[model samples]
Target: MSIKPLYRSCDSQGASQRSDELRTYAASLIPTLKARAAETARLGYLPSETIQDLEAGGLFGLTTPRKYGGEPVSTRAFLDIVTELGRGDTSVAWVVTLLNVSTWGAATFFGEEAADEVFGGNQPARVAGVLTPRKAVVKKVDGGFLIEEGLWGFNSGIYHANWDMLSIPIVDADGKVLDYGFAMVPKADVEILNDWNVVAIQGSGSSSVAVKNLFVPDSRVTPLSRSIGGDYPSTHLADESLFRTANMPLAALVLTFPALGNGYAALETFIASLPRRGIQYTGYSKQDEAPVTHLQLGEASAKLDAARALLTSHADALDTWAASGQYMPFDDRAKVRRDVGFAEKLIWEAVDLLASASGGSLAAATNPLTKIWQDARMASLHGFVVPNTNFETYGRILCGKEPGTLFI
Candidate 1:
């Protein structure tokens, strides 16, 4: 009962366990990720080969357009990859999920020329970005906007990305802000600063970028509002309905999976470790034989199930809407918000329960459970998953209160 069963169960061929074609590819990569995860955290950057393997595994282009030699996979498939990666190294998973989301966002919003340019020569290029358009300088240029600014807290695949998306406000000649555009900048045009030392999520390499007088072409920039409004650059080529869905929902999807993975990781570790780790000074035959331990495991897994349900339900809804080519209304979007909030909350519940059950062994620096506890705590602090804040926002919608944000 010394926590070995949990690891074996994860590797078993149970259909419910995390073992499918995508998960297998992801699981096979765990040895490399686990080997480098600590180094990534200590050095504040991921090795180039780690990035290469991820791309070779087809992780970076999870949602890329199929027309561009990409898979354009489902959102659930994307989450499963994150989950498998998170099981071995939460930091790597954190970085992959965020970078891929930015990549997918770019493919969904940017024009055909832009998609080909980014994902064309590069088979699995990571897209690093920050979506908050703050303190930016933008002016109209020959063919696009001239932007010279830096983005902070940019996470996931920063060192590995060939292109970056910086959130900037496009200003007209009159100095009036025209629109909030996600400006894609080539890696050479921007400089990365290795200033990503943090408390919990240390391995993300969440560095800052510095740029001066970088001219981004019109094709590379996408107006976020228009992308959500159904007027996207991909309208001419692929179906623009991908962008027709709510931006808030898409944003929430990107945020939910990493934490969910961490929660699932904690549950799996606890369950696996339970068989060997007996209670201190208590004569329980084995931790697994104890009635109390069984209760805790069930409770922890139930919380994980709730979180997964929230994510899959929202993904199914969005997929249905995208397939139907229908413009989703506020009501449908509100459901997405509700689902995202519930999933995030459920992650904390699972993490809290599993961490409590893990006891002192889980607190060790080298233990996977330790990282899961820290990562889950940090994930809750993310802006999108701050518990009651989103719940209150969703509650207001149910009570006939108009959403205050433009996303819904």
Candidate 2:
């Protein structure tokens, strides 16, 4: 059976205008988010009101296909929204990023039946995914595969999603491995585990999920190879630029934006406190009056700016390739991984500098800077942001050697 595509193209000018509107809307919510940051942390997840606000504002569907009542905004616009949200609260931003990115992935890779099940309604669907395979048991059936059992951890935003995507290893009747694929399962079929307790980004609700003997139809599964190569299942949306984006690079890049936002928030928090803050017996009435403070602030600002530059540059490059209907080369993808990691490093450095300069006062749990600092540190520890791995991969690629990783 042939499946119809669910996509509509917007002119560049129209898309940009819509993106600006979304950005403006996201910016307007920062104050409210900042006000509820502590409460969100306390709850270990985003407040219902905050989730409703984001949903009503269409932030959750930023990258969804327009046919599904989504804005389907540009990558730059998506990044801007994420960064702005992160500036308010990293936890909220991280959850939103994970939700939106997973939605985008579902739209791009899932078969039409699954896409319709997810995005066919009046409202946009919230989707979350964990790509890392965990205790997955795949058994082939006549029509689909029986996922007897599976457990995926670090499933950010799963608490709020209507659907979840999980990685599975495909096997034949003989139990020989065939390929790695993703399965789109409804939220009702899975069990959420209370395992999200963490010191940073605590409100993200990134917990573990367990599935027992779930049957997924073949139409809803997508092979990792096809997604990585941009050979998506949604032929109806195949012509859409955003859907054509390279999957692995997009995954690597989305994880970096929250860190960027956290960095910006840290800088702002530190600067705002400088007027009344003292240097702790350094003979300075205000920390801002000290020359050393000036140097530290300037250095942190520059580092953050550099990180933003790298992030936006790579974002634009990805968009350019998508819009031009060209595949992003492997080498370029490797460089993007390296650039994202480097950007993360710079963001963390800026946060650390600002936190150190703010002194022991920031040790208070109530201090917003403390949360931002902790969030940045924790976010930088993500696999995608590991400096050594990315740098080594890029170096290997440059040296004409194979990058030992699959998700280039």
Candidate 3:
């Protein structure tokens, strides 16, 4: 059977209009998100109301194909919406970001039949995925491979997802490994393990998923190597730029937007409380009146602005390459990863500085500053945003050496 292509040409004006609508919708959800932030953390999962709002707003379909009732907005629009959501609550933003990117992957990497099953009839599908393979056993069968068993950790948004994309090793009948790829499975096919107890971003519901003797058809599988290099299986839609964008760096870059929002929120939270807060040992009745406070605030703000600039530049570069219908160069792709890590590092540094100047009381659980700090710290520690690995990868590329990591 021939796979149908889902391609629709979008003019510049239509794309811009859709982006504006998405931005407005995302902005409308911020107040609700902020109101529910504490409750989400307390419950270790997002509120049902928040999930409903996100579904109604189409926030989970940011990168999904428009032909499937998805928006397919510009990269800038996607980042803007994610950052705004993050400003309200990092955990919520983290979940939405992962869901949107995974949805995009489902549309781009899977066959048309799989896409129809997931995104047909304007249905809103929340997909959570993790690409790191662990203890996965694949055996060749007649029509597909039987996923004997596998466990994937850090399945963010799994609590709300109906579908899951898991990375697994492809094996031959003789038990010889062939290539690493993804398995698209219904959430009911796997078991969710409640083990995501963390001190930060606790509401993300990043649990582990386990599958046993599940059969994944060939149509639902895509090689990780091909997807990373922009060689997607949905080649019938080759005219669309969204499907052409590099996958690995896109995944890495999206994680930083939420951290940016958290950083901005930290700055806003600290500055807003400055008027009533006072130095513990100093005679200054108002912290805002102190000269040291001014210096710290200014430094943190500048750092945050720098991080924003870097994020914007990298996003623009990705869009440019995609629009031109060309493959992103290895160096440029590496730089995107580097930029994401650097931006995350800057955000964490800014948050730490602001938290330090906010005084010891900022550490109290009742204070929002404490949560913001913890969230930023957790976001910075993500495997994709780890500063040292990205920096080394970019540095190696700059020095005429191959990037040490395969993700780029």
Candidate 4:
């Protein structure tokens, strides 16, 4: 069950060289991932072989601390690797992104003992969790807190994770809500309800998990508000800049890559199929020979390019702030939220255009384009990345009003 690091002496390699090697490794898995896409969907989770391939590639540790033999890759580098994986299969890419993002959050915010428990082992840790608490009850105890009872839904990547980072509301002796914090708990302590039947992103296996009377030590918990404001408890902040980046912006930006990947794959799939297909009821024997086809392809490609530019810019900004040893300001973070939402919207629009231009044949369940379109649309619907909500929040901030959500 132990997973070894991809390269033992990664410190000897330049950042650019290390990034390129990781991206190349992800690209090399596309063929195998594509071959299993159908099986992944049918099973409602990534196949075991796909998980093994990712582990061998050292992808799970992309966001892990170097002390634990992880890369702690830059936000931009992590985004690039996820995009490459997305090109292979959006759901598979999505799961990997969630695992890494959760791992990053855990390592950055929680105490060192918690980090060691999760990532210090020979086997790389995959953490899956949700920020919202549902039906949760907590109580103060001698050394820590007890869950009492709780349920957290949409636990993406839960199927593969050995630990979970759950959000909970701290309470006083009178049961009055004191503060909110995240609880690090072993997966074995919770009950997983495998009810993630959905129309899109089926392979993500985002099932619900429940915990009853669980005891969480104080060392495994971290305050939520301070962490969101860029104050963390991890001692690595002095040496590692990656842990200094703002949390919300990084979370929002990472979700958008799945859509970007779908756009890339959809465009690739449509272009590859164009030469052999004919325009229905038209004079043109080849779809590629038609003027309308050119327009559609042009528009889709342009949208994708714009999305990539926006997402990359947002990531670079986070890196810049992290390097400067400053927390990203509220207004800047608000803009990041807006940018991520818009980027996903553009990607969804692009994929939809490609799907439409491909004709009715793409409606088939067996077609890759069909899944790509569905997954892209699903990515846009996420609450954190929704275009309308994010746009409104940014607009509010611009109008000298509150962003209205703590998530920013």
User: What lDDT is reached at residue 100 by model 2?
Assistant: 90
Worst 10 residues of 3 by lDDT: 1-10
* lDDT: the better of candidates 3 and 4: 4
Q: What are the runs in model 2 whose C-alpha is more than 4 Å off?
A: 1-11
**Candidate 3 structure, TM-score to reference:** 0.94
Pitting candidate 3 against candidate 4, the one with the higher TM-score is 4
Candidate 3: residue 112 Cα off by (Å): 1.7
Could you tell me how far off, in angstroms, the CA of residue 389 lies in candidate 4 after the best superposition?
0.2
For each predicted model, how many residue pairs clash, with residues at least 3 apart or on different chains?
Answer: 9, 1, 0, 0
Model 2 Cα displacement at 376 (Å)? 0.4
Give the alpha carbon lDDT tens digit for every residue of 1-408 in model 3: 111111121328878777667666766777788889888987777899998898888788787776666668666667877877887899999999998889888888887888888776444777889989667978889888898889999999999988899998877889897888888998889898888888899999998889999998988888888888878778656767887788888899999988988888898888889888889878999998999998998899888888887887777777888889897998788888988888888899999999888777875888989999999999999999999989998888889888877899
By lDDT, rank the candidates, best first.
4, 2, 3, 1
Model 4 TM-score on a 0 to 1 scale: 0.95
C-alpha RMSD values across all candidates? 4.6, 5.9, 6.1, 4.4
How far in Å is the alpha carbon of 61 misplaced in model 4?
0.6
Weakest 10 consecutive residues of candidate 2 by summed lDDT: 1-10
